[model samples]
Target: MPPLVKLVLIVVIVIAAVVIWGRVMGRRDPDREIVGLTDAVRAKVSREISAGHKINAIKIYREATGAPLADAKRAVDHWFVPGQGPGVRDAAASYTAGRLTDEGRARISELILAGRREDAMALYAEATGAGSAEAQAIIRTWDTSQHY
Candidate 1:
């Protein structure tokens, strides 16, 4: 093969390899990772649950980890029962209540969408609990709307 043709082919192969490798090894679901809860932390929550501690401790765990509000929501929802669904709009309300900027709300919203209703609600509770008034408001709206 010509040198230029060989070089092009090699480049294409390298790009394809990188893409495939990324898909195989990279995180496929940001929402499922339970942001801020290391395996160690999760193990602790498990132990606590096994020991009869309140399951809500996990939510507190997400809050303490300093994960983004939205991520916290996603994490809690994943662990919580009854699957109240992601309360992203609620979190936004809380964040707004706490006086977070539009950028902050947008960030949390994106995180909420990264998963589903269950995860989103947990994050929303965490965000509002952390003092996002806007997030709280969103939750109230959801509660009132009967759509959540």
Candidate 2:
């Protein structure tokens, strides 16, 4: 084949490949991504993020959704964008199943008082190494188990 013809053929093939790829792999919607994440998974991701555990949150998000780490990180970051999260700007304490420090207990109370339940779970997880669901269970008894 002539050099000019070869070049034209190669360009045409590349263009065809590009068009096919675009059609097969449609653009991902950032706002609509991670749609299958359960509410519990969301709470866990949010909890990890709130407790300053970005990597863990990303890992959890990735594992739960099979999303790439970068995508999970982006989604996790989006969770705290003022109006994006569960409206939690603060974090707090340990849990009964964990180390539950006095400070942790007090902070848990504060978090509960502020109505930031998810953040309270995150805090409990932070101080005591409790899992999200465990932290939530323990937090549920905060009012009933204590004299506060």
Report lDDT (Cα) of residue 67, candidate 1: 54
lDDT of 1 by residue, 2-100 (tens): 999999999999999999897555533445644565544654544444355544555556544745445555665455321123532323334447744
lDDT against the true structure, per candidate, is: 0.49, 0.66
Quote the positional error of residue 32 for candidate 2 in Å.
Answer: 20
Clashes of 2: 0
TM-score, one value per model: 0.22, 0.38
lDDT of 2 by residue, 21-118 (tens): 96665454556555467656766776676677989988888767867656777888876421123422222332333466767677877887788989
Q: Which stretches of candidate 2 lie over 4 Å from their true place?
A: 1-35, 81-148
Candidate 1, residue 43: how far the Cα is off, in Å = 14
Q: What value of lDDT does candidate 1 attain over all alpha carbons?
A: 0.49
TM-score: which candidate is best? 2
